[model samples]
Target: MTQKLAGRTAVVVGGGQTPGATVGNGRAAALTYAREGADVLVVDRDLDSAEETAELIRKEGGTSLAHRADITVEADCESIAGAALDTYGRIDILHNNVGIVPAGRTEDLAAETWRRGFEINLTGMWLTCKAVLPHMRHRGSGTIVNISSMAGLLAGGETIAYNTSKAAVHSLTRSLAIEYAPHGVRVNCIAPGMMDTPMGVDANARAGGVSRDDVAAQRAAMVPMRRQGSGWDVARAALFLASDESAFITGVVLAVDGGFSLRAGIQ
Candidate 1:
């Protein structure tokens, strides 16, 4: 069988991961794209971490490069597009997997914290899209995959900042999809639920003052699949959205969750 993304070039933003036992969504997506025969640009605010991902891909005999850019910065986002075009001469796929889970209730949340969350989770995505859209429109075809969370859809989360911003991502995806459909650009989103990523496990463990295994088990039990999802699970979903296999699909919010979202509002 032919590789789904053969001869394509993919730009995977937020490609670095937190230190933990599991892979991150961005790194996994970048690797998955490479494995399927796409040259990759692994971008992250953390230059060292980005290089680590790039090095891993190189070790696997895949073509990849590391780039540093803070998504919150407009110029940096523009540079991301520029770098990709300079390196590969064209941009085929753009996968956004950057997010932060800031815990706080609406009543107690700090103004700065809420602003920061929106800046990173929402505005950053818009900026990246803004930077890349011109190039894509010029070419008349491209694919963009934005990462969201089930928290965005489900109610009752105390993390107001995370939930609201991610929810906005859903809106952003659909809005871009319709606006750019005529230009032949497809925009889609993935909402991951109960993932066992470093951000999900390690961060939660530290914040909750519990063992990582305990945290993992607790989250897994809530999932209908009886297990928390890994980065690879989300990566596979991103792969489908970024490839021509889903050429006819767009403006979709594909949930990578394991039925957790399905149980929303139940006792």
Candidate 2:
């Protein structure tokens, strides 16, 4: 079933390569949006990785442009949104996927580390939304999908900073949704569980303090589905939020976890 996001334009932040996966969430979402007929703006801190994603989209006969900008920087966020508007003439969807999961407890995390987490995960989203709001308001319609994590909903034992930052994103999504709904703009968030993406693998490895496969197995064991999710899993969820199919859905925190969020502590 093709999601008809045709003729619309989408901007996916953090579209770059992680440790294990060839493509990250931003890359997957960009390709999916393009496949569905939306022009894509693939943004990442690494220009090379973003270009790679854009090249794949172009090879697939889809329109995509790569933009390198550090979302943690307010100026970069403004420039990115401005560039998208200048190139595309409008911004219909903004997919905020910037996040970093440094493994540590609150005591173990340095103040700088904690601040960095907020800078990239929560503040970046806010900056991007601020930069794009005027253009979206002028158009009188827009959709914003912020990528949170199950860690946002539940306590993440090791990554306190990451958890807190994501939780902020969830709240931010709701606030933006309510405030902008009257303007025909919708905002929502997807909180995904353990996904087997590059970032997931790296996070697992760090948390486990072991080989990548060991981390993967540990993650799979925790999930009821007996496996981790893929980038495409979250990509599909983003597509739903970006498309008109979810025209009435706003301020929703859709968990893309495969029953992991539902499982009780095993006996």
Best by TM-score: 1
Candidate 2 C-alpha lDDT tens digits along 1-267: 384888888998887676573356777898999999988898989999889889999999988899999877889999988889888888999998888876688778889988888888898889999998888988999999999999887777688888888889989999999999999999999999988887888756765588888877888999999998888999999999899899999999998888887894411
lDDT of 1 by residue, 1-267 (tens): 257988889999999999989999999999999999999999999999999999998999999999999999999999999999999998999999888877788888889999999999999999999999999999999999999998889664588889889999999999999999999999999999999999999988998899999999999999988999999999999999998889999999998888887777522
Cα distance off (Å), candidate 2, residue 159: 1.5
Q: Candidate 1 versus the native: TM-score? A: 0.97
* Candidate 2: segments with Cα more than 4 A from true spot: 1-3, 206-209, 264-267
Model 2 C-alpha RMSD vs. true structure (Å) is: 2.3
Question: 9, model 1: CA deviation in Å?
Answer: 0.9
Give me the candidate number with maximum lDDT: 1
The RMSD (Cα, Å) of candidate 1 is 1.6
Clash numbers, per candidate: 0, 0
Q: Stretches of candidate 1 above 4 Å error?
A: 265-267
